[model samples]
Target: MSQPLSVPESHPPPALIVVMGVSGSGKSTVGAGIAKAISRPFIDGDDLHPKSNVEKMSKGHPLTDQDRFPWLAIIRSTAERVCAEQAQSGEVNKGDRPAAVVVCSSLKKIYRDILRGQHPASTKMPPEDDTQERHPSGAHIPATAALKTYFIFLDGTEKVILDRMSARKGHFMKAGMLQSQLATLESPEGEEGVARVDIDATPDEVVAAARKAVKDMIGM
Candidate 1:
């Protein structure tokens, strides 16, 4: 951790990077940018949400911890699966960079913890009635159990986020819910492997800052 932040063009081994923030903080955009820059597959957390959750959000309801537990599990599983594939194939396509970038809101610390292979007390629950249960324990990403899991938080102002969300259309998340999302978000300020980048700059600059912070945290 004492090393300088900047690395050469090369990057470290494939780590699970969750480009996390509230709905409109550019998680998907900047996450995709980072993955493209590092040659890893990008998985959007929004796409992983169950239809019930999406419908609820689209109708202006904030999801409960229970609603999010399964979604977080899916994102973590995607990351772990990709990392395992890279390891099995013995591919270093990005010079040690991780094989996947997960783009998700990851609003709460417990959610981030779940993504990092730890179950929070509040989020742990027994299997539901459904056959396709999506709890964290049900869909484990074994490769991530001992790997470096990083959270790249896209910090932004409430005004900025509102504007971005308002401009979008046909998305499950509604602008009216931004306030709740902001309130629910627990910033990854002191968490290890957490990187914060202000969202005031161009996408390229934001990605650059994210990489520098990641390099500093993981010593790339």
Candidate 2:
């Protein structure tokens, strides 16, 4: 049998870890691996992209900021909702619900800002008490710190990325579009609560690096 992730001496606080990278950087693979390592639920952010966005990407066109705003909003909302649900259910989990992992290509810093609830330009912050806001399950949810986001960037060279992309199939993101994705990516360095790791390693090895980065950030 394969070995389980070794628990650190100190358990970390719950967090929303967004696995960020270009299309071929293995965001989904490493993201799921880290979720398993952390014993948390996994959410593929691509799954939440609007059909319009999907259609655009399928045609190999790069998404403009306008094209991305609505989609980013949805991803932010979904991440927040997951964190809210986990926060409410944490006690019931008896400390078992550590966190949630989001597999996303949060390419730019502005995009990442949107993911973390930084209001877009010309937008006002919502009022503290949003009476209209309630969980879909009809539960009263308090204001959430659930928007807290940390990025785990799966770094890779263009050659490696193109090779990986070339070997994959049945995806809307064509290997031809990799350069556009890489061009759109913003370096996560010096950003609050971000970790970057090279993906030029085995899947488990990549996950281990990601796990340690997450552990360090959350103080595991």
Candidate 3:
């Protein structure tokens, strides 16, 4: 009889990173590149959305709050599982380094709120946005030792992002939808545990800036 191999009891925590922006802002492309550079797994938020949601988006219809509820739930579950897995494991293995990056259009404060709520105790002090009032309760659950939850806001001029979207094809989100996305977008500032980087720069430059910004925000 073959002997059964014993699996390790624990592993390292995964980073619960949300690569967010409106359509045409390069969330998926930049997220994949960042995941590769960091040697972590990347989960495109598009893939997590239900077929109905995709259909709605493809039809140029914007998703309502209802449409996003279940989708965001899945994201939360995945993040929770990754964190639990790491907690069970003593230390993070190179193989286990959190590679889970979710590329989604986390456009509004409400949308970001759902993701941030996963770790209730992790919200830093509220930023000084007189226009914004809803602040999450506490610090979010730590995703990995390297990060609790890292948010990357891909900021770019409307013309630039619109132009890039116009050139891309086959994606469900069309360039025509860019205006709506822009209308819905909420800018990230300090105290949201987010690192904002301009997308007007080259991809390498953007990525470098993103990394530096994230590290600076989290002290990682």
Q: What's the lDDT for all of these models? A: 0.70, 0.68, 0.61
Among all candidates shown, the one with the greatest lDDT: 1
Off by over 4 Å in 3: 1-14, 51-62, 86-91, 94-99, 118-147, 167-176
Candidate 1 stretches greater than 4 Å from native: 1-14, 50-62, 93-97, 121-144, 163-175
Model 1 per-residue lDDT at 166: 62
Q: Cα miss at 99, model 1 (Å)?
A: 3.3
What would the per-residue lDDT of candidate 2 be over residues 135-192, giving only the tens digit for each residue?
2321222223444678998999988777666667865565557877777777888899
Candidate 3 lDDT: 0.61
lDDT measured at residue 23 in model 3 versus the true structure, 0 to 100 = 77
* Candidate 2 positional error at 214, Å: 1.0
**How would you encode candidate 3's per-residue C-alpha lDDT over 1-220 as one tens digit per residue?**
1111222334433456788888778877788777676655567766656556667999999877777755664465455554444444533463444435678888877677667654333323222231012212111222322335668999887888866666678655655577777887877666467888789877788877776765575433
All candidates: TM-score? 0.74, 0.74, 0.68
Clash number for every model?
6, 0, 17
Which residue pairs overlap in candidate 2's backbone?
none
Model 1, 30: alpha-carbon shift in Å?
0.3
Q: How large is the C-alpha RMSD of every model relative to the true structure? A: 7.4, 8.3, 10.8
